[model samples]
Target: MGIYGALSTAVTGLRAQSFALENVSGNIANSQTIGFKRIDTDFVDLIPDAAPKRQTSGSVLAQAHSTNNVQGDVKGAATETYMAINGNGFFVVEPRAGQADGSATFSGANFYTRRGDFELDKSGYLVNGAGYYLKGLPIDAATQNISGSVPQVLQVSNAFLPAQQTTRVNYELNLPQLPKTPKYQASQSSGSELLSATDFMTLTPDQAATTTGAATTAGAATSSLASAGETLTIQIGATSRTYTFNSGGSTTMPAIDISDTSTDTIGEVLAAIQADLVTAGATGATVGLDGTGKIAITAGNATDTITVTDGTSGTSATGFNLANGTTDPTVATSTALAARVATVTADQTDDFLNQSVSGGAITVYSSNGAPAQIQMRWAKVNSTENGGAERWNLFVLTNGNATGSGTAWTRMGGDYTFGADGSPSPAIDHTDLPNLTVNGVLVGDIRLQHGAHGLTQFADPNGTAEVTTIKQNGYPAGEFVSVAVNDSGRVVVSYNNGQQLEVAQVVTANFNAVNQLKRMDGGLFAATSESGEPILDNGGGVIGSSLEASNTDISEEFTKLIVTQQAYAAGTKIVSTADEMLQQALNMLR
Candidate 1:
């Protein structure tokens, strides 16, 4: 190659250096742009075909090199809808084609972008700062699940959310073993801490079962006293009365004598005993013998208990087959027929309130968006310490202010019994409240779900129920308030009714050869043969309330700028020298 050839090569060098300088200038200009990827220039040399030793570099060419795969610095942003990718990904987007019928139209073609400064437009479309619309999978509000895998341009509106009826309530709580209720005192008996079953009974009177002694000879009341001066004692509550049998004395003599074995028959002896009980202020007490001549005794009131004892001197009480101790005629057990009334009558409302402890309350919505607050209470019907299995009953107040003859509360039917391990005996995971009506609003049947081992009967020193989790799957109708993106790439929308729902799923698109994508305006990219098809839902995590800064480094671009300037000047110097040599050759020829 001669001087002319050198001039042509110099020209190519200048072109390449100019291209490099242009790239550096562009990088420096967009150094602060959001989600900007800087471009670099690559030089390729052209060689002439010749023998191995004779081959020479002929020309130079400049080509644009992409830095699309490089990551930008992510920083927090003020906008809630703005997002940034932590690694490798692009947000699926599309440009608006045109407006028709006063509505924004979208081009069916999909474009990928890193600019996530998105906001809700007037038409309810999520558009970015560059006017590109975001694409995502619509989610079912009721089921809270993504509709499909295919993404479309999302348009979220501020429409009112319809009310949902309450179907189920998730509940998990711990019940105290020994509830220290208001009616319980340390000086009281061990079972006093539990609810009084008699106070809420409506079917039958809470009467103790009659206690019968061993059978004796029929109508043969003759000298079984083992001698005179034999005494028998019957005590009710704090009052005690004694009966002494005297020879030849009337069955009602001595004001405390019940019978004489020589003269009084068994019926007369029992009658005298009943009279003595009336005189001793045991008003409702009864003393009698069954048809088989067995001595039977009954207590007066529900609260009063009876204790019978034999005298030390004589076998008079023993002759009647009565032992020394408290009689079996005691208050009815909680499981008795009367204490199992399912509904709390108005007359028993006060007693019900005093027996049961608060079990928390929650407001639920009806199908028509009507709101009703449900109040719950837990009653300990039986305890292990009281010679019964640990059992409980849950009740809901129907009418707090109900008076005589009206229903006040209704029991959610179940004998919630617990085993020794503090877990439900049969594992009660759920129950239902049938047509629960509070105050006057009727709430349909709702399933009360208690997860595995959700209800516990532990020893709580405070003697209060601890509700760990209580939430219902229903809400009143609400107006939309705002929207936000989460780190999990879900679009969450908030409402005025204190409801937050996942309305859409924002998926990321990735490519095999991301650097080979065709760059477009507004930080967007189009797929190319070399870039491969868009692979979705497999990209890096999305960071919400943040933005990705430009990948261009100002200092590096400035350095390249200086180097390109020097190279361009050197190329110009080579052209000047080549022209001077041509002039020298012409002068020599002259």
Candidate 2:
């Protein structure tokens, strides 16, 4: 029984050494494989019985163990989708069931792999060389955030992106402290110039008789019945009917009557007459008394003009004249916008070369994703004339379909003022450009936002009006340009409109006992009970555009190969010696 047992034990030793040699051979074979983990033979001693000092060594068993925790040398690759694990995680993947319509179909059953030489398939799915599809979390286009917790087979679409309307425009700039082109010399604020309003020339006349005359100063000049015989006439707009008036008589609207008594001040008479003309629709203008006791009428826009005829009699002859208010289309054309604004000095006489003016052009998208170019012109409103304080009036515009002076450049809104430091004081709000309807299309209201005094008034040599940061929350319709996998495991897709969108985030699966994973074909592994359940790892262990080299070293594998060969030879010698001894025993029995 002892002799037979010795022979069986020697046979087991031969088998164990051969198993170790097989492991060494396999390691050397897959030395060039991507993400290949080397296998090592673990020898276990099997003993039959132990009798204190005399124990029989039975045989040896060889078990294949994996060095899954070992890291491999990373190599750069030309493919953008090539990835390598840097830390302790595996790329979550799934095997494809079959190919249909040139697209690789997923099998739903999840698997894991260290191999990441993936490429986009026909259906836009990222598939590895081993036919396993990469799994990742989907990213919402609007939010650009991961949608769900569980990962799914990632696929990208090559569809065109829809046009989006512009809501906000962000601007950050540094303006010079000096005027680029001084447009104002007035001491008052350069308010927005309007089009439909006009303040008639200041009035000057006799005290008693001139009481009927328009005075730029505040005064009480009543109507005089002594000159009630005079007749007054007025008209409005480019083509309006003239209205006649009489003093101390009853009148209904456009044919207004003046007071015969000295009770009515010059302002009261103008107010009454102006009200009657507006009600009659002869002029769509509002009339008011200026501080100089003069009459100021406004129609809110530059489309119309008011024409008045001060009768050469009582109030009409003395206080009122054609200069007070007129329907002459050419009279108030120059001062139309300036007269309405409170402190605007649009009529300043300053040299254009002395002032610094900066201009910038930016493309803003409409609600329908239509492209519209916005021309921003900044002209210095205050210069050395107002001490050293620097101020600017920014004019936003777009080329309109019109060819006339007032209609050529479609002004977006009123002039915006910048502070001495070149920053907006109140900050730009929603500026409506009603006339900016290019050929009838409605471009939405645009507002400028500056973050943390983004606009500065620093002096520069080149007059460089740098748009440090200018961005809009809108884009026109665009076609897919290209796709790339980022280091953060995000799949970024670019569009022809210069916009990039993150479509998906690749997820990784890691195990507590990675060494317990069961090896499979093509550098893949299956989770076992010995290997802990797969956990979601967001540690960003995967690097894109690179590949991981096999952990198996040729020198180490050759060394193991040499030792394994010698061990196998010794095992064979043991078997041969055991056979010889058994033969001797058998001969002795014979």
Candidate 3:
């Protein structure tokens, strides 16, 4: 019985070694396989007795252990869809059981694998080298997000991709501290007139209360004041005073006499009237010309008034007429009221070639595959008003006239204001554009965002709008060009319209005890009770345009092969020696 037990043990050893040799052979054969996880032979002893002392040489049992978590070399590949996992996870896949004319059917049971040499099949299914279909979370077209938790078979469409409208734009620019044309200056009323109602009027109560105040003012003309002999009469605080201008050294003044029809220098006549008023005991009565060369008269007292007809003998022929009033009125200072400039007309606005500083143009698309050029213009607003406030008014041209001779430019929300520093302020972080509809077409509202460090106000001698960044989210309809997997484990499809869309997110599965998984055909694993349940993982990113090579090493497998061959040979020798011993015993019995 002992002899036969020895032979049986040797036979078990031979079987175990043969199993190990088979594992080695498999590893060696699949050394060039893509994403292949090598399997190693595990041996266990089956003892005849439970007690250690009584136990005989036990038989060896062979079990398979998988090196699933071992990483393989990810290499570049020509195929776009070929991807490799960089970390610990397997791509969720399903084996096709049935195939019809246009589609294939799956058994609904998920299988995990590392082989990712995938390509699009006839029905748009992503089939790998092992004929396994890849599964991933589908992205909703409307929301552009993963829809459900359960992953489904990912499909690629060969049809044309629809267009997307521009909803948001990013912009960063530096406004130079340059000069700008004053709109208020063009709108202000001009001041120039002869002595009449246009220049003189009844002073207001508040103005009258001030003893020394301007009655009226006008712009200077090349001509001088009325003739030197003109007698100008002014009522100061109820006392009418008359001053006569001498013809000596022709001079000009604010008020000339009604009798004088010939003109003279205003300066000389004003000095003569001032002398006369002082002599009449009305020293406070003053007459002067402002910076704009407008004549102004001040009464001696608060209640003093300068009625043009006070001392005149009702002579309308030559006397300074007060009944007829002038439109321009004199103020304390020379600075006059400026006009408000809101919208620019064709004449006020500038053309693309002339007015714009430095700007860039971008092409955006509408929903119906309509391509429109978005022209940007940075018109200097005010460099002198706000103490060197570097401000630029942005304008958008949507199929607008390039000449800007018409009202084709639509102004963007606010002026791009830049401070002294080279950074932009958060106060003008984002501006909402006006045109919901462009060129009679309905597009969504576009919002432009400027980062904190995006804009600058430095004095750029070039006077061009130095744009730092510009981008928009919009594309026209495009035909399918290619598809690839990104590093984030997402399926991105490219189009002929120079656009890329993330269609689906690849899903991965991991297990706590990977060795316990049951091995399947084509380097696959099935979850079992011994192996923990599959846990969904996204940490392992995908390498695009690459394939994972087999983890098996030929040299290691050959080394194990040599050991397995020697062990099998030793087991055969033990069995032969045990057979000879049994034969000898039988011969003695004979």
Candidate 4:
């Protein structure tokens, strides 16, 4: 019996030791396994009693009981709670697709795993080695939450590919004002002179009837006593100016045929001559007859006058008044006309133009006669499909809405494509979308949508997606200022001149049970059932720059190994003692 007991005890001891060894080996082998938990073993004893001890008498013959310490329970291994469970969850894996969808789809397979190694695929999706995609909420192209389901099979469509080459450039300039002056002519006929001519005299009838020629003391000749058909001559003044008349002419002084000759016309001729004299190289005087049968002569100034006398004796002398005196005309001054040519200067203001963005997409505008809005879209090289076909557009609005306002998004330019080989195509012409107006002012607010995750408007509200107003007065060109992210996961932008603004933000998602994620060999985790549903959490509170670490504890595992070893050793001692007693009894029987 002792030998049998010893054999059973030895068997139990062997079983216990083997179980302890197995646990130690497992712990040592999987110490590096992420989320791996070590196991522990417990042992109990078994004893046989022949009868119960009674308290009646001294209980001298109390029945001896067979005692034994043996392995009883071999419980299934329990995992440490601290370790992230590879429980009934699925690993989320992402695949690469083009930007047609702009976002990745999740595979619904519920494969559970504990691995967290991950990396980004060529398409910019976070992926694992097993090719299983990590599941999370579907983020819009702008990085905002679209759906609440945890992304299982990550299906990343291509990123919004950027245009390779610059398709077009915009410009605005203020043109300067022109100057003006008046025209004039230089001539005497321009009504700039006065007239100086007159003709009024008196004569007697007796003087007119005289037939013979008569001589006067004043050097005058008359027709009264001279023989008929005889000629008479008379001289006047110290110069001896003379006149001859025929006798028997029926007039005392032969009608005193005195003729005045001057080009001045007895009026304006003097002023005309004077004006002519003022000019360079004018000489002499000309005598001519006027339309009124008056003889006129032109000389240098008004002081030069002509006089005439009658040759008859009985008639009184008549003087010629040749000054038809009208005032001289005046010429306009030159300084008054010059004042209209003053220069016009403009003040420098905040009219922003030529707005642009980098590392993302943006919209810009121009301020001039009317506000014009320009839409600019940018993307990285690797994400777009058929390359980047859509590039930029220029929008001109008739209504008073600011550039790039609602319903005002008219495409002026064409689509542009960018190549991976660093070549860029020209912008292709596109159809206008629509026209928009607001408060009688033209506003420009360009909308840039992201291709990844189908997210929109992830950039700043006032920064990228809001309407931007450009001034009409003097303004400087807008320069690229900074970058930002929007709620829709789209990239936003700002300008130095405060002209252009838009949204730009990255998208993020959270899983119900992150520990249930599958290991794709890399650092990435795929979604599984063990991992709960994915939640959309803006990078606000929980996940910023942190990473999850493995949950293996070497010291705790070692301590479990020690306890298992002692239990095995004690079971072996029970089997040995039982065998020794059996051997002594066998000797007694022999």
Candidate 5:
């Protein structure tokens, strides 16, 4: 019986030694394995027989011994703590699939894991080397809001992709200040007055000279007493002309008869006078009979004279008047000519060259070489139905006169209809207007708008319509420049604005009882039923800019290794001692 007892004890010792040796070998083999926990073996003593002590009281027991069985301790492999996750979440894990849905769904069940080593696949999904995707809630592309709940299985190959670069840019500029033209005034009257020539007259003489005392024709002066003076007689008529002079110096004419045939008519006499005037070198003279039948002559010079004569007869009498008219007005006089008032029609095609709405003035430049001026008074209004409205007035001015005023600019053109709801359609084609020119150069102003929410402005001097694109240069294609994380645990990748999206995110997983996690060869754990569902959190939260290092502590592992080796050695010694005792008992039995 002693021999059998010794042999049974030795068998137990050997089993214990083998278990301890296996644990030591596992510890050493997986020293470099990630998440590996060291194992240990334990022993328990067998109870002595209580019935014998009660039944045979006071009888000395020949052999009092206890049997033991080897039992291994199944402690949690390691005491290392997970550095991340305190508050509201767990690291989410995704499954790898041969094919993935566009909506990021998976056909196989999602298996939670603690492996965070991740990189981006060529398709931009956050993936591990095995191509498993990390899962999270879907987000809207434009608004960037979470769209839906996280799917049960997030495939690594189906993660959401972000835009590579900016799509547009916006700009606004402040308009330059300008002077305002006055309004047109129509009631003012303003204008100036200029001097013009009308007629001329002429004069003429009748005879040379005449003597009072003359001799009678044909008969000698019959001793008419020439008292102290010689008496002369002259014949002075046509038919039988004669003149007698008395001694007292008085003249008497003989009874001479003028022949009717020798007398000239008024017409003939006028013709003769005109002929004599022309022969005497008179110019600009007219001869005519007035109401009294007397011949009158008008000439350019006041002091000139005219002589007349018949063709075959003696000299005829000539008479006239002479005068000159005033000078004519000069042709080069200057009067108040009205200034040219140009009229231009406003068109929809006019470019919004320069629109300045500041300092109570609005100046709009048109293609007609002048800027239209409007005085604006802006008012703010609140309305739920309609957005808002602004009133404007256009003024016309010319030479300090306001020709037109208070014209409403309700719309850019009549074709543009404004809705009562305060929304306006695209009515005006601004590009059609000539380029806004300042000092003969094209320029524009920045435009700004304010709403109930906030204010935004653009700096678009070149008038570029689209305002969103951002371009980056001088970077390598695959180099990573920056990284960012959002509120939803999704990691964003930046690659010098170039080709590479190195790694979107590194997915994490959690468990209910992390101690129950099955350790894999690497420092990773496979999920089991004891571990709860993974709570997904973003990389932005507690794990920002941080990396999870291996949990193996070299000092503690070395200590555990030494303890395991000693325990194995002790178990071997127990087996050897039990074998020797059995051999001794067997020899005594022999």
Candidate 6:
């Protein structure tokens, strides 16, 4: 290993430098390529085993080192279908084997790539710029879930989507406590605000639901001269307010002042008590002595149950025959309408509009893809301020074009009541609208799902129903218009009918030894024994509407280019020196 050995080593050095130059050139050329992983040359020494004293410097060999694991800068793209991998992973793809009947056919072999310049091809297949088709799991539109684990070449079908009938409607709305309708006048005290119970004749008035107290017999007797302060408590539903008997009627709730229990007649005291009850949010309450001189109290709204408690002074309520520890027996239920008219007739349309305020409206689809717009209105029947349970009735316009005796608006069901806290008393989570037909189109019976606490009756400044959310699970027939990939790696296909349906889920594959993968054309890779099998679900993430820049750095590649050139020249100089030495040896021999 003398002159020849030196010459052979110099030649190997030149070869390794050339390989490095080639890698640098390739890296610089594809510096702007999308998702391109640059290749770098690695030098390996080929050393021969020898004794310690006779050891020689080793020859060099160049091997390709991949930068597959290195990440590139991600940039936004105009195309929605274009995507990028944010971290360690490769998009599962397949190459088109050939064309059959003017359609692309794929070979079943799997290839992986970071290149994501994907766009919907003419055949509805998502293909990248390099002609590799993307593979993913198909999603069921009905269930909105991925169907299978195995991924295949995804092809969005342009076929017309069949119509879906509306099965359920999700409704969330807040009804105004005081619905100011057209008939309402702020100046008027009574009958200005529409009352649905009396206006629509929906519920029958209870004839015998009165609770009577014992007689206040010959009450000219002077019961103490109002020295000890006493209070009377009246509770309606869950709300309670206390009334204090004061010498002067001046308190937060306008306290009742029977100046002198002896001078003030029993009727005057009872009248003042009735005024206090009305001030405390009792609607249409009748409190007076009957023909037998017994005190009587009746709630106007048949649904409301009332309870009256006497004060601890034992003089205030006990004088009116209301026992100290007894609750007056009252009716707890409102009787259903004896002659209930389920819907408002065409002639009653004007009356209904003046009585009820607009709830909201939504366009729903029928079984045959027919579209119909249904308008809703709410009529508050009874109010706590009016001595009744806060109640309302819902109605939907069924036929706007109906004439003569046709039904204009149909009531949904019985009255919906609210508690003192504005939440529905019965918790109307869902209700069935039997045979719901809108504008002559049969929409079938659909369930109006309110969920938990969906409907609320709260005081609104605008005095109008505020609808928050209204949506239905129905769509008319749609034609595929475009396709895009979402952030979650799901392929969404848009239709001409303004509906976007999820069709497929994009899948990525990971490798244990990513750099050991076999590189192919178009930035693709094939699995090798060293790279191991593809891991399907461990990808970092799929970024939609973006493209990953090439990992190659142009400035770095230029610097390497200069170094390779200098090394090649040095190797040539070493070869030239070896040649000159050989020439000298020949001359000496001569």
Backbone clashes counted, model 2:
23
lDDT per residue for candidate 3 within 1-590, as digits (tens), equals 38888899899899999888888988888999999988899999988866777777578899888898898899999998999998888899999889777578777889989999999987788999888999988878677788778878898888898888887778877665552222223243321110111111333321111123233233221123334445555654445665554444433343444233333334544556666676766657775664544455555543333443322222223223223111112211112111112333344344333544546877666678676777776665434342223445666664354233445556576545455564544366777865555555666677777765666677666545678899998888899998888878889989999988888989899899977878788778799998889998754688888999999988889899999999999999998999899899999976
Q: What TM-score would you give candidate 1 relative to the actual structure?
A: 0.80
Q: Candidate 5: worst 10 consecutive residues by lDDT?
A: 191-200
Error of 6 at 245 (Å): 33
Count backbone overlaps in model 4: 121
TM-scores of the models, in the order given: 0.80, 0.70, 0.69, 0.32, 0.38, 0.77
Q: Given candidate 2, what's the lDDT at residue 342?
A: 21
Greater lDDT among 3 and 5 belongs to: 3
- Winner by TM-score between candidate 5 and candidate 2: 2
- CA deviation > 4 Å runs, candidate 3: 50-54, 99-101, 142-144, 179-356, 385-391, 396-426, 436-445, 451-455
Best by TM-score: 1
By TM-score, highest first, what's the ranking? Answer: 1, 6, 2, 3, 5, 4
Q: Write the per-residue lDDT of candidate 2 for residues 525-576, one digit (tens) a residue.
A: 9999999899987556778899988899999889988887888787778778
- Compared with the true structure, model 3 gives a TM-score of 0.69
Question: Global lDDT of each model?
Answer: 0.79, 0.64, 0.65, 0.32, 0.32, 0.78
User: Can you tell me which runs of candidate 2 are displaced by over 4 Å?
Assistant: 1-3, 98-107, 182-356, 367-369, 383-391, 400-402, 410-423, 427-442, 459-464
Q: Tell me the lDDT of model 1 at 158.
A: 89
Compared with the true structure, what per-residue lDDT tens digits does model 6 show for residues 1-590?
88999999999999999999999989988999999999999999988789989888879999999999999999999899999999899999999999999999877999999999999888999999998999999999889998999989999999988899888889889998888899888887643564444344344322222234344543533133132366666564444666666564333343555555533455665566566566666666666666676656555555444666655333443444353221211212243222334688788788888988998888889988999887989887666555456878788999999887788888897768998888999898987888888988999988888889899999998889999889998889999888888889999989998899999999999999999999999989999999999999723599899999999988899899989999999999999999999999999976
The runs of at least 3 residues in candidate 5 whose Cα sits more than 4 Å from the true structure, single-residue gaps closed, are 1-90, 95-106, 129-131, 152-488, 493-509, 519-527, 532-545
Model 4 agreement with the true structure over 28-104: per-residue lDDT tens digits: 77666543333444445544444455221111111111110111111112211111211222233344343456555
Model 1 has a clash total of: 0
Candidate 6 Cα deviation (angstroms), residue 363: 0.8
Give each model's clash number.
0, 23, 21, 121, 50, 3
